[model samples]
Target: MAKRRKAKQRESRAPRFWGQHAVLAALENPARTIRKLWATHDAIAGIDVPPDLQVEMAGVADLGRLVPQDAPHQGLVIEVEPLADIAIEDLLAGAGDGRPLVILDQVTDPHNAGAIMRSALAFDALGLVTQDRHAPPESGALAKAASGALEILPWCRVVNLARALDQIAEAGFWRIGLAGEADMDLADALGGKRIALILGAEGAGLRPNVASHCDALARLPISDRIESLNVSNAAAIALYAAQNSQESR
Candidate 1:
């Protein structure tokens, strides 16, 4: 009976969002369906709890048991259903501002993916694209890393990344894959056209097949002494470069 109960808990689909930013962001987003809210007395005092939502008052030690070990919950945690998936076609249809889009090629690290989302929002990118089978799902750590951008950014998970690249190309995006070994620098390769900045997982870099789908491959102007930038940092630099390039045009 205990084993069965533990299995059920492990299989639960509801995502628990911890940390002040993650919890507060979800509370404010109208589209987020919050199932339960647990907070310390002091934490609850500052929050404007929704009248219709269920809330539980708990002590700090009690709250610790509810989240992963060593997680900094900041005295709040929330159980919520995953956000509804946005269709790639819908994202393409709504792409009018010429904002660049980011496509992650098997970036499975939740923290990295979340940080990329934060950068995407900071640079006014259209959205983030990941393969449905290889991407990290919305989770507490990811949400915490995103620090509220997860609620604002549109994330589209597609089945076949190569096929999606074809569709994005059909919509007139100039896809540029970032590779450490690429001959051209990012700035030299970018134009005024709408762009899709493609980044690969750390260490492995962009797969050959994915690179083949891009309009061009470019590299950051980093020194050879350091091999590569962390995926999230690289993303921030790429976005900054793209924004500057667009404004200069």
Candidate 2:
């Protein structure tokens, strides 16, 4: 009796997470079992929720009670576990048709990372590659920023980024790093059977060795007035350019 009572208590105390990515992912994935859903009035519109699933309609403050203080839940939260990671070998082997990949070099900001994931999905990117230590963990802010893209795209974290770039190069990818001060524009430098768009930290840019690993460096054709564009925005533009270039070729 005590054991059963303790289990019930633990179940009740479990918190729900919010953000479109987190909620929508839970809904889409059959393996992700949802305990309860707390949604804002505006967010819950035009959805047929399962009758058995627990539903709570509440405002931001009520939603805040479920997650950490800093979580940007955006008025929707669903309790769930983390997704599994895919092996590098599998991802590379599947890169058979020579689709483009976006390699993230130490861009750890969750909002930025999440936004990149969203863009990657939008352009049908192969996958997002990030260094394990430097990448952001899956969280509410990331999920919120992803806006449901976190579920579809595979975010792979590797130990050695340089070696990973080498593997990518050996696999027939023309690695192009996005730099503000590069001599060539992005469209001019995109030449290959497969392309890996390498992006680095916002202010710091790509590391020297990482840049050297790439076959070429390219700059976005943007205003000379501004020094740089936001990292995620730059990624979206680069992905779009790469996909377009691939299609043209």
State which candidate has the highest lDDT.
1
Give the per-residue lDDT of model 1 (tens digit) for 164-187. 999999998999999999999999
Candidate 2 per-residue lDDT over residues 1-249, each given as its tens digit: 000011112122443557765787768765455778889988888666778888889988888887878687767788655555555665777687666899989898988998998999899888888887788776667777887787777666678989989988887788999988899999999885789999999999999989999888999989879888999999999999888988987
- In TM-score terms, which candidate is top? 1
| Candidate 2, lDDT over the whole model | 0.80
Task: Please give the distance, in angstroms, between residue 129's alpha carbon in candidate 1 and its true position after superposition.
Answer: 0.5
Model 2: ten consecutive residues of lowest lDDT = 1-10
- TM-score (C-alpha, index-matched) for candidate 1: 0.94
What are the candidates' C-alpha RMSDs?
Answer: 6.1, 7.0
**What is the overall TM-score of model 2 with all chains considered together?**
0.83
Worst 10 residues of 1 by lDDT: 1-10
TM-score of each: 0.94, 0.83
Task: Give the clash count for each candidate.
Answer: 0, 4
